[model samples]
Structures are given as C-alpha cells and as structure tokens.
Target: MHSSTLFITLTTALGLVSAAPTDKTYNPTKTSAASRTTHTVIAGRGGRLIFDPDNVVAEVGSIVEFHFNPLNHSVVESSFDTPCQPKDADSFFSGFFPVREGQSDEVFQIEVKDTRPIWFYCAQNNNAHCQSGMTGVINQNFDRQEFSLRAHKELAAEVEGPSGVQGGIQGGWRIPNPNPLGGF
Candidate 1:
C-alpha cells in the first residue's frame, strides 16, 4: 500500500512538471504595466527611405511602434544573415502604408519577445528602398561588431530584390496612430 501511494505521488508530481509553462509562451496581458515601454520608430519620414532612430534597444514586453510618414513604405522582419528577405513565414510584417501628405492614420507595432536582434527593412521595390539602405534593428548585440546594423545594411545593398509576406503577420499589430501629426 505504501508503494502504491508513493507511485501516485510521483505521477502527480510529474504531471505538474509537464504542465509548467515554457519561456516561449508569452501572454501580453500578464506583463506588468510599469515595465511596458513604447519606442517610436518613424518610417520614411520627410520623404527619406529610412527608419528614424533605426537602432533601438527594447526590453521584452516593450512595444516598437513604426509610424509611417508621407508616401508608401512597409516594415518586414528579416534575419541578420539575410537582410532583405523575410526571416520566415511567421515573421512580423506591416503591410504597405501609403500617405499623400502628413502621416498615415495607422501605425505598425511589434512587441519585443526576447533580447535577440531583429532586423527589418522597407520592402518597397519601386525605388528599391531596402537596397537604398532603409533598414533597422531591434535589440542589436553591441558586443558583436561584425553583426552590426551597418553590416546588415551593406548586405541588403547586395540583394537583387527585397521581398515580404503578403500582409501583416501574427507577430505584429497594426493600430490607429496615436499621434498622426508626429507629436510626442
């Protein structure tokens, strides 16, 4: 009888261990309000094919908001090795945002899930924006000088064409621009 009791206890403990959540699971709602920060990144502002403040160091649970300016542009996630191509099908992408003047009514935002670097670029091929040096990075590893944003941009210059997903992916969010006039 004692052996049976011990067996049951071990089984229950094993079940609990198996049910434990892993680091891969992220629940945005559970993140503390005080720990959350919003980093603004302007896209193609002032008719320039660039992401103002192109390099940002954002913590996990923080949001990187990409505000689109006049003309059309998009933000697509890519890996450091492949600068202009989408990192994967699950990568985050902000579908093209076109504005005649001023800024777009919407903004693209992605939450930082980990400290690893995230490379992105504008997939606007009409003017070859990505090839022209429209790229940005999030949480870049400063210690690795060889894998810097400048190097990524250089690699992007060599790409024949930059490509992106059909539309926005699951890893990003597109919400109404809080400041359409470029305030704050």
Candidate 2:
C-alpha cells in the first residue's frame, strides 16, 4: 500500500510539471537565420498605411518584409511606449528613421522566430499612423482585435521619437481625427 501511494504521488507530480506553461518574453536581442518568406506590407496605398492582404502567416524564422509608405514612416515593436524594437522578421536590423517624401527606408525585413504575438506600430504621429489603426502582428493567434492593439501600442511609442525626430505636424502619421480607423 505504501509503495503504491508513493508511485501515485510521483506520477501526479510529474504530470503537473509537464502541464505547466513556459514563460516567453518579447526579446529583441538574439537573432536566428531561418528559412525566410518575403511577406510584403505596402504603406500609402490608398492614402493610408495598409498591409494589403491584412493577414500574414509564416513559419518561425521567416523573413517578413514591410514596404514603407511614401508618407514617411518607421517601424517599432508594438507597445504603448513606442519601444522601436522592430518586430518584423528579424531583430538584427533594429532602427527608427524618417523617410524622405516619396521615399522609404528601403525594404524593412526581419525574422519571425518566437511563436509569440509580436506587435508593431508607426513611429510618427501620436501613433497617429498607428492610432489611426495602422498596425500589424506576427505569429500567435490573430484575427483583428489583437492586431489593432499590438500595432497601435508600438506605433504610439515610435511616434514619441523612437529616433528623436517627431513629425511635429508636418510629415507624421496620418491620425484620423475624432476616431481611430480600422483596416489600416
């Protein structure tokens, strides 16, 4: 009876341990070179920063490309603080810059590694670009709500000068006044 009870307890403990979830952080340091997929997101297509297809799906370590807008834009990690962490496909090309009129910062590419819901935003307006609903996501379960939140949050932070150059009412994010616009 004692031996049986001990075995049962040990089995239960092991079961519980295996069921526990692991902790994953939004890391922007380490980079892994995996098979890449050129996922292009076009900006300034219809007077808005749009990701065309709206939905992008890829395996881990794929290289996602974000074609910037002629409206002058930047990329950043989806967060309220505009961390400018760059959540595209890879973390190696992390940066924040203002593209010239009718120009962009080249093909923004990064690697999607972790299977976490990565977010991003435009580092221009008061997240005007993002707040205006110009945001996107990678990995994790995504539909609509999740994309808006993650994209806008990071855009907000980016606009706050992720590169120290605020739009200041000129070439910034086109924030739809009065309300936030979706499908951007």
Candidate 3:
C-alpha cells in the first residue's frame, strides 16, 4: 500500500479509538461506593406500555438496569427536544425483547458516561407507546411529570416510526432474546 494511504487508515483508526475511551467498560466492584448505585427501570410492567417511575437520577458511574416484561417492548435513546424520535442511529437502543407473559428474564444494563440528563423511550411499533408518553430520563433536575406531559403532547402531533438502530453506545450491555420472533 502507498505510504500516504497507510497513514490515512492509521489516523482514522486511532481517532475512532480515542473518541470515547471512557465509554468502553466499568467494573462496579472497582468503582467507588459513591458512584456505584444501580437504578432499575421496568419496561412494559403490568401490561402497560410505560417505563415504571419514568424518571431517575444516576451519577456518572452508576448503572441503569432495564427489565423487559410482558409481550414486546424496546428502549431507544432520544433527545428531550425530539422526545419520541430517535436521537441518532448510533445512540443507545435495547431491541424489541420478546418477553413471555409473567416472565422477566431479559435485562439491559447501561452505564452512565456522565451526569448529564439522558432521555429515552419505548419504540414499540405495534402500539402508540411513545405517543402514550412512554419516555424517561436520568439525572434530570427538572420536574419529570411536566416533561412527560409535554412529551405526550409533542408525540400527538406526529409519531415517527421507531428507528432501527439495534446496537447502542460503546459501553452499553444488552441480553437480547434469542427467539426468532424477538425483534432485533
């Protein structure tokens, strides 16, 4: 290969590696006690298409554990401004988990990269989950009830079909259902 071509390829590879090093992995056992809380969020609990609590506050090193239950549901990252729409293809997404009735074995664990408020929603396509206000946030300082109310209104204007980005950020972990019926 030409020297110039080789140099370009190496530069691009190194840039990708350094862009988000902190997003790679975290050992909770090793993390300080002050930054190691684990917050749980139930998805589709009680057959209702909503994230239980719908709002949370987590520190930079905390873990957000999402438990999927009853029928099918998904977790997709979004922006407070967009509400129901996907923030970007590269953003976090817990693909449709084909959870059995009364069962809740599937869980997705995402580590917080910063203390910034992170917004997300259920991208269930068979119903109007997002429009029904199936959204949530972490580390938000504002009133969640008010934000949820506005999100419902925004979704009412137009509900975009959920984005198809199956994988999420560099450090996010997921246990996807293996059944072919499990929408990946």
lDDT of 1 by residue, 64-174 (tens): 999988788889899999877888888888888888888889999999999999999888864289889999999999999999999999998888843655554457889
Sorted on lDDT, highest at the top, how do the candidates line up? 1, 3, 2
TM-score of 3: 0.65
What order do candidates take by TM-score, descending?
1, 3, 2
Distance from true location, Cα of 113 in model 1, Å:
0.5
| Worst ten in a row by lDDT for model 2 | 171-180
Cα lDDT over the full model 1: 0.85
User: Which parts of model 2 have CA positions greater than 4 angstroms off?
Assistant: 1-35, 79-105, 142-184
Between candidates 1 and 3, name the one with more favorable TM-score.
1
Off by over 4 Å in 3: 1-35, 143-171, 176-184
TM-score of 2: 0.49
lDDT of each: 0.85, 0.51, 0.70
Task: Pick out the ten consecutive residues of candidate 1 with the lowest summed lDDT.
Answer: 161-170
Task: Give lDDT tens digits, candidate 3, residues 34-72.
Answer: 647778788887888778867787878888988887777
**For candidate 3, which ten residues in a row score worst on lDDT?**
175-184
**Residue 107 miss distance in model 3 (angstroms):** 0.5
